[model samples]
Target: MSNVTTINPATGDQLETYAQLSQGEAFAKVDACHDAFSQWKLRSLEDRASVINGLGKALRDNKEELAQLMTAEVGKLLKDSRDEVELCAAICDYTAANGPEELADEKRDPNNAGRGIVTYSPIGVIYGIQPWNFPAYQVIRYAIANLMTGNGVLLKHAANCTGSGLKIAEIFQQGGLPDGLFTVLVIDHDTSDEIIAHDKVRGVTLTGSDDAGRHIAEEAGKALKKTVLELGSNDAYMVLEDADIDKAVGICATARLYNNGQTCIAGKRFIVTEKVYDEFVEKYVSKFAAIKTGDPTAEDTDMGPMARDDLRKTLQQQVDKSVENGAKIACGGTIPDGPGAFYPATVLTDVAPGQPAYDDELFGPVASVIKAKDDEDAMRIANDSRYGLGGGIMSKNVDRAIELASKHFDTGMVFINTFGLADPSMPFGGVKNSGYGREHGGFGVKEFANAKAIFVGAE
Candidate 1:
């Protein structure tokens, strides 16, 4: 069997290696998960929720260890890693408290029947293909929802964060999850396809690139299995003519640099109106250039290395290609002399079509600044992309911004006058190239459920 080795991006140190499971072994695990689903789906929602609630407690109890593992494997800031664990715990808590109501049966009126009832029933096993950006949160986001919906969960986490995936499973078991109900598959891409083809695997979900999503969706479609894809995005954050320059600077900087700018929903494009374009770009560059990059474990560090060497290379290539296509570097464009995969917080100005910065997703600590003639042009530019995942609108006019976000901003989620991440109460997903289906806000629990309609008539 082959093995995958994980490295610490901040230190270039080999952390650990995990052996991949062969096709037969992976299939056996799938069978075991299916067998466990048979029993898990029979349990009452309250009973399943009780176990899920314990998962939050277990996560908090081992928060430090999980955080450190994440930092070592993915080069995420230590503080960010700790916060991710807390977020995972919160997801568990939210799913446990709100799942029953979301999945409860509903009564409906029928023309010919005395009464009609609709019930949300569990399907079967669900396989998740998650990324490494937020290891704990990514898995917990979908796993807890499906588990609370009375379905079994299987994970195929990014190879770099394999340890985090296994640790999460261990924590679930300690939280009283039944054995084999939540499994982690350590296999190659070929084996993963086979697992998707397995008849026992009822559903598949992925949070990765759009290309990977299409491939997985095609395979699942051939097998007639359902799939939920949360893919990549080049989210735009627009600064309108009436925007508060100072506030926009701070919010936009955080939106781009958070998680070292590896977030799919993090602001990649900055569309600023001509009224405040120069002022916004000046301060934005200062903010990015002033950022301190160092060891992820250091308390003073604001940004860490990218998750891997290849990711850094890909980001640099995009930046260089953008510059060659008429985009100009406003600040911090060059790669520093370092042993780690460290790319400075970069800003490109005069960004327009035909440039990677304008046309594609720059999945790193790079920001593209484009100037629009006016507020209308700013909104037009924001919506002029194949991606519609998440974005932000900066404006002093809260009412106008709200109206635009509610009506004109063609994205799944939008932040008005601020920068933020996913919330347990809000539905998350995107449109177009960003993929489909929704998660959170009680939407995920129904994604794999069987909504059965029943009717009764008086004899």
Candidate 2:
């Protein structure tokens, strides 16, 4: 069983190679995890929290190294990588701090005949299948919370971040935790699927594309296992006539450019009202053109290359299709002059509904600008996608903003005054083709646990 290869997308350089576990090895890990889970689930929440606290400190201390690895593995800006590492550490800290109390029971009416208290308890091992874009951050959120609930974890991080994935598994082991309490199943897709399909896995958490999410969901459904899928998004950014044009432009740049536009919830479509669409477009185009794309390892780089050559080609094909369908590029639409998978930050305008760019998620530094006659049309255009994930609404009228946000059709979460800013306190999930279940806050804790209703005096 050969290991997965890790190549830097920016320079097409092989950074490090990781070995995939054999079929027998994968089964061995599951067996070990199950054995460990049998006891881990019996541990007190306080003890679990103490261990998680140790994990949190480890993350904080290794923040710089984690950031460097993150940038080297996936093509995101250096600064963004630093912040993502910090966020990972913070989530670990949060789980260690508030988890026990969050698991506490809520006030229920005691007038029910022979009623009792609701007790929250651990289930078993949580199998986390995360993507490469935000590798360290995503796994930490799932791991810390699961461990806090006294459950062991198995991580099958993306094929790209093998080094970081291995590092994560080692960190938990070094934090004085049990051997199988936190482990990484370094295996191929088939092997990983077999591991996830194992009965002892208990539950699964996935953060990836819609296609991959659907496959995992199908397998989990067949097993009758609980699954939380944070799937892909074709999010829209709506600009009302009364929106602060300059502020909208600035935030839009950051929202779409984050992760080199590889984010599932990156603002892909720009639905702007016609009255001020021109002004917004002027500023937005200017900002897009000014973005500096370069080496992800460089500290001064604002934009990094596409995560892989295949993804870059796909992005280029999307841009080509849009242009062929009569869409005009306002800023950039081609790969930059380099050996890496670097593409310039692109802005498309006059993107008619029939254009390829209008219907598909241009999963790169490409934003399609659509014209809307009014707020009604803006919301209409935003809700026209088959993918209902996340959305953004920039407006001056607070009430209208709320109303429009509430009225969005194919969206799960809508953000006002800014783009999608995910927080551990917020309930994060998607609707429609974007998949189901959440990965943050109280919702996340329950995803890995089986809620059993305890009733008494009825026998």
Candidate 3:
């Protein structure tokens, strides 16, 4: 009987409400998904690819509606929502095109000189616990890859984006996905835990905070289920002495504010060499100050409100605590009186180890600027973090940046001279407290698969 409501963060207006599913009902849903998987897992990989191709088309056919709903639900810019849908569609395309080959059985030589076959077989059902940011893409990122592997998928999306979750299921069905193959569970945490322990759920994946990841991993561990976690980050972007200051400024500015600064892999810390520290800080603060914050649906708006009131409040408190601990605000430190959960773009300087600005992931449109003695110091500071999700290196010397990224950077993914997000062709995930495992770039297809080995005696 309990319900969850979605709101427009830009206007503080209620959008819709969805009733929560009971624990028994959620378990039944899992059973139904497993039943569907019984049949789905028997389908040819080529057939699954065809259905995935249709998913991409279906996403494109309904991109506008999906984008609008996402913007309303999470306060993401309209344009960004459209781009997110496109990215999701592209993930489907990439999976469909590459899945058959990636999941195909491989021949291997055994010690007995017999033929050994390694087959990537689909696990039963995969349970995904997703966040509100990048609603469509996050679900598609794991869901499509698993579907291509011939597994059933269950989504427990963030409560704020419940509608988006159900809509996505509808779209998959429209695209020829089998019934119960892709089910959305509108349930509370207790039910989610039960679902995770369900006999039908073969694996689990989550995109959320490090604390949440740790909890989920522990729970999944108890059940002896595999888990893939993509946790939070305070990703650092370094500006080297040989960097083009202008390009670095622009790229870092966009990277820091992308997805309204909700992206887990976004550039949150700006570590600049002493040579360009003044120049980069001046330009970066100015750019942050100029980014227009308003209604998410407006074309002229450069930034949208934070996803929720409590999230905005938490970000403000982090900024306040950071300042009290020695960090200084260069611009936008104050919370403005507004109708919605809006916070202006903020920049903090003199960010040191003790402050939240230096040590934590500020999951909002806030930037932390740190000064380093030189390129060596900047690299040292960048690699000092315990969270190694993603980071960037900006330098005029492309070769040196590549070398540094290849050898020195401790993060999972690195960007040279530019800021970037996830790509269908590249693997995404992190190490350290950012959690483990990988997704995308064909890695996701096997995350929950069983690579059974069969050997045939030589004739």
lDDT of 2 at 234: 72
What are the per-residue Cα lDDT tens digits for candidate 2 across 319-410? 88889989999999987676888999999998987776898777788988889999889888888887888999898887888877776456
Model 1: CA > 4 A from native: none
The per-candidate count of clashes, in order, stands at 0, 2, 0
RMSD of each candidate relative to the true structure:
0.7, 1.9, 0.7
Better of 1 and 2 by TM-score: 1
Better of 2 and 3 by lDDT: 3
Q: Which pairs of residues collide in candidate 2?
A: 3-19, 3-20
The number of residue pairs in model 2 that clash at the backbone is 2
Over 134-211, each residue of candidate 3 has an lDDT whose tens digit, in order, gives: 899999999999999999999999999999999999999998999999999999998888888888898999999999
Off by over 4 Å in 3: none
For all predicted structures, in order, the TM-scores are 0.99, 0.95, 0.99
Worst 10 residues of 2 by lDDT: 105-114
How does candidate 3 score on lDDT? Answer: 0.94
- Candidate 1 lands at a TM-score of 0.99
Q: How does each model score on lDDT?
A: 0.94, 0.83, 0.94
Write down the TM-score for model 3.
Answer: 0.99
